[model samples]
Target: MKTQQRVGAGPGRGLAAALGATVCAAVFTAAALPGTAWAAGESPYGFDGGAQPIKGAATSLDARPLTAGQSYRDSIKKDGKLYYRVDLGTQENAYVSVVAVPKAGGAAEYGDGITVTLQDGSGAQCGYQDSSFASATFTRPITAYAHRTIEPDRSTCQQAGAYYVLVERTSKAASPPDDWQLEIRYVPEPGVTQNGPTELPENWPSSSPPPPVGGPQKRQGGTGFHDATSLRQGEWRADIEPGQTLFYRVPVDWGQQVFATAELGSSPTGATGYVPNALVLSLDNPARGHVDQNTVSYDGKPATLALDPHRPVAFENRYSSHSTTNALRFAGWYHLSATLSPEIVKEYGDRPVQLTLRVNVTGTPKAGPAYAGDAGPFQVTADDRDAAASGASGDEAGTNDGMVVVAAAGIGAGTVLLAGLGVWSFAGRRRAARDAARGGPGGPQDGPSPFGPPPPAW
Candidate 1:
């Protein structure tokens, strides 16, 4: 019996979902995973004990390509065809050992009973390779402490990606009573990650590619280099075929203090049809200069961006399978921006930043005519034409006169101080409730004026 599982592969749309197969050890999972990172310096385990034929039918460019270990002389009188490969025999960052099919031909003598199964090339089956049967098998095979965690199902296989084997025949019968051989053991990185860390830099390439500048033509002008290999390795994928429109020219700074931040990547085939991802920032550099743009649809692998806050300008495509490409087939790729907050050249002074990137292909913008610069010259005078047409003023007529009567006298003094604070707190709470309903000294209408001092003169 034999078994290995680490699941986690996805499927559903424009692509991106399939990564989870790095179990490395219940018996042998080949850990250090990154979508299936188990290259433990060459051998995660693909079997070499000797029976042969277990790696996904063969070398698997699509499957079927092995030759050194295959033998099946009519078992169930039918079953045959297997493949596996991985014998680095040497290390130093090198990898590819093999092992992921688990059982089909020998092992069973008391009565010829053996069952080893482990699948994920999309046949499903994953639970029954008994070390004891408490659940799935694995009391042996895949040495160096163990290994067997491959999850490749070909939608582009990448649940943990890294693959190289596919052994099959999970029923085992027709010739055998013992002596099972399939033990791939090659320890140099037993726990994995034996030498891959210093923070980052094994090949150090995710994309820092910055270099696409060629501005200044001025008269309906033109220059070059728009993603020039994204400077040779920073992410600039291409596979277009929509309307095809990709052009670049950035040196924007035309007049009008700016503050830029551009990021727009879209993909739409239908839904009223808009296809966003456009960035234009053109003024051809005259003062501020900003060109941040967007237009995503090589399925979302666009480029050109940097704002540096220490690294605060962005536009990523998340690409790296050891990338090395530039096959140009445009349909969409845009990212434009403008930022220059000193009031954008303080109103036109540094004249020297022109921009013109094109990409709206079938939707309209192939960009052609637009050239005319510097406009400044005026002379009206009639007291400057009554303060430019009548905000009328001899010396600024009464402080720009009646701004709606000063906002209605400041809303009538805040409505008379809130009606005198709501009538002095409601007349001081009704005069303390009429002095507590009069339970005090003077009663009988409260003395002092009864026919008055009549007997006082006697």
Candidate 2:
């Protein structure tokens, strides 16, 4: 297919690059403004995450219970399909994600695939998806999440109450009998809050089309930004094998813009009919809503695909090119998910593909409006440091009040020095303690994810 069009050239592209750049710039400028940093409110709707391990699949008709706004992880053996029971409210949205990890010394075949199904209590099927290795050998972790049920008004599975999640290997026997790790989390989005950003930037170019791709630029990482080993201002490195998907989370504040590119290491030798676009990188906004998708094509050299929103962050119109609207309307932990083409793995054999993921986060985290209700555990206003202190239950002291007070004192003292210091210094002191309790850097564990087409039938 031809490369993506320039921003705002097509329908809905009006929210094109202009929206991207100007919105990001305005957000950042607002953040940098004095006394605006601490006012940021956290998003009230998201994963109400509390994880519990599934001991094993229930035998017979018995299914393990899964709670909404919680997460569960466990291992399942080959040919073993685990079933879990879910009880959801009529207004609540349910999501489930299953990640299949091949055991050490296992076949390591990237073509291995799995099937996940959601069924209502009365034996009616609600939703189902099959994920494959996609013909690549160097496999990374394969993950998939989808809403368990259609919206309440929909015809199918409309009622709330008991539902089932079933997971089983779908790949051929040649792949080997490896144990797979299953991370399952069900998120219930509180239906009460408004679904869009607090505000849109002025002079947002509502009438004009977006310009061409902006050239590359440099970005600097803010201090105390590395809490979850998240992608920062500069570039980060990762290795992905075919059939495997790697995930990285970058915290973007209300005003900041985020741009990322995945450079595939090298094309496999003697591979033919292989599409140059061997890699697929997807961006999910803070609420785990998919925003953009791009691919790295391998011509003679490593093909780089810009995986940012169209216009403002990068020059390419990935929104139109990918045929998906950019839904990056909010701030928080936007996730970068990378996967390789199975065709490459089929030809190259299972081998690690070196990749450089260049992530650019521009703008600053300005304070957000304080909502009437408590924000979930995840806060977009605070960086990794504050997120760490909040922990899963979100019971940290001096949250919004602490930051604002400290920042005000620093400003009065006539120094951005203490401004930065006040924002992160105390938070940094809690880092060691938080890390010890929360464990190391990890991606979002909750499972509700975008539902899309499965791999083509063989």
Lowest summed lDDT over 10 consecutive residues: which window, candidate 1? 322-331
lDDT of each: 0.21, 0.47
C-alpha displacement of 179 in model 2, angstroms? Answer: 1.5
Candidate 2 lDDT tens digits, 199-273: 233332223223213222221111111112344444445566655455566656544566787777565563443
Candidate closest to the true structure, highest lDDT:
2
Show model 2 residue runs off by greater than 4 Å: 1-51, 56-60, 104-111, 148-152, 193-228, 232-246, 252-259, 264-303, 308-331, 337-355, 360-379, 384-458
Q: How accurate is candidate 2 locally (lDDT)?
A: 0.47
Which candidate gets the maximum TM-score versus the true structure?
Answer: 2
After superposing candidate 1, which stretches have Cα over 4 Å from the reference? 1-84, 90-92, 95-163, 166-211, 215-239, 243-272, 275-458
Model 1 Cα displacement at 130 (Å)? 27
**Model 1 global lDDT (CA atoms, 0 to 1):** 0.21
